[model samples]
Target: MSQPSPQPDRAAGHNPRSSGPGRLIIALYAVFVVGSLSRAGFQIATRFQEAPLAYTLSALAGVIYVVAAISLALPGPRAWWVSLAAISTELVGVLAVGLWSTLDPAAFPDATVWSGFGRGYLYIPLVLPVVGLWWLWSTRPGTVQD
Candidate 1:
């Protein structure tokens, strides 16, 4: 008798990122994308001459959030790495922007999404990346599962 062809892997449907708590991470990122972009758009359009740096930074933060959310929701190794990079970038951005804004308040007459360590957003921008990085590390493929 001819040997039967092996069945397709059943685990193909499993997506570690978006299967559980990752959903919450993606959701939060989505909210940030909307909030930051909206603020940036309004500021840039209404008064670009007033706080161009702050408005531009807000727009950049919004774009980062969009990348983070999409990568977190997608499946596979590439997406995981993209998510990692995005989250790491976000953390650094928040820290640098926060410190800069704090030490040199004159540099940022208006707040960006990450100004004062996301103080304007209740620090969600500060905390979200930490949580996202933790989640990515914990859910990485090849980990021993129960």
Candidate 2:
């Protein structure tokens, strides 16, 4: 009789087994999720009138970050695609907004998370998406694959 191939063990629920860089990526994502959401909420509530466009973009960025974080944390193929899409969109958004802000300061009297490549936030907003994409790519099946 032929022996059966062993099945890969998956973590319970959305949680993945914390090992190597997975744990670090999850931690960073969680922090960004909270940070983006908090900044967006504060901006929208306090001085949204000052820069409606910037504030709205901040909120949108927050939503994207939250979705990416959740999807990355989850264990499954669906989560991978979700995270990839969110991260890619985020990268594009930051780049476009950053360039626009640089070219036309008048358009954005106030700053956004993506302004100047997230200069106020120490460029984490700019770098986060790159890291996210790399992490997702690394975790793809056949490679590290999370």
Top lDDT prediction, candidate number: 1
What is the per-residue lDDT of model 2 for residues 72-107, given as tens digits with 9 covering 90 to 100?
777777788888898899999999999999999999
For candidate 2, list the clashing residue pairs, or say none. 139-145
For each candidate, what TM-score against the reference? 0.90, 0.84
Clashes of each: 0, 1
* lDDT (10s digit) by residue, model 1, range 19-77: 67889999999999999999899999999899999999999999999999999988777
* Candidate number achieving the greatest TM-score relative to the actual structure: 1
* lDDT against the true structure, each candidate: 0.90, 0.80
lDDT, model 2:
0.80
lDDT score, candidate 2, position 79: 81
Clashing pairs in 1: none
RMSD value for candidate 2: 3.2
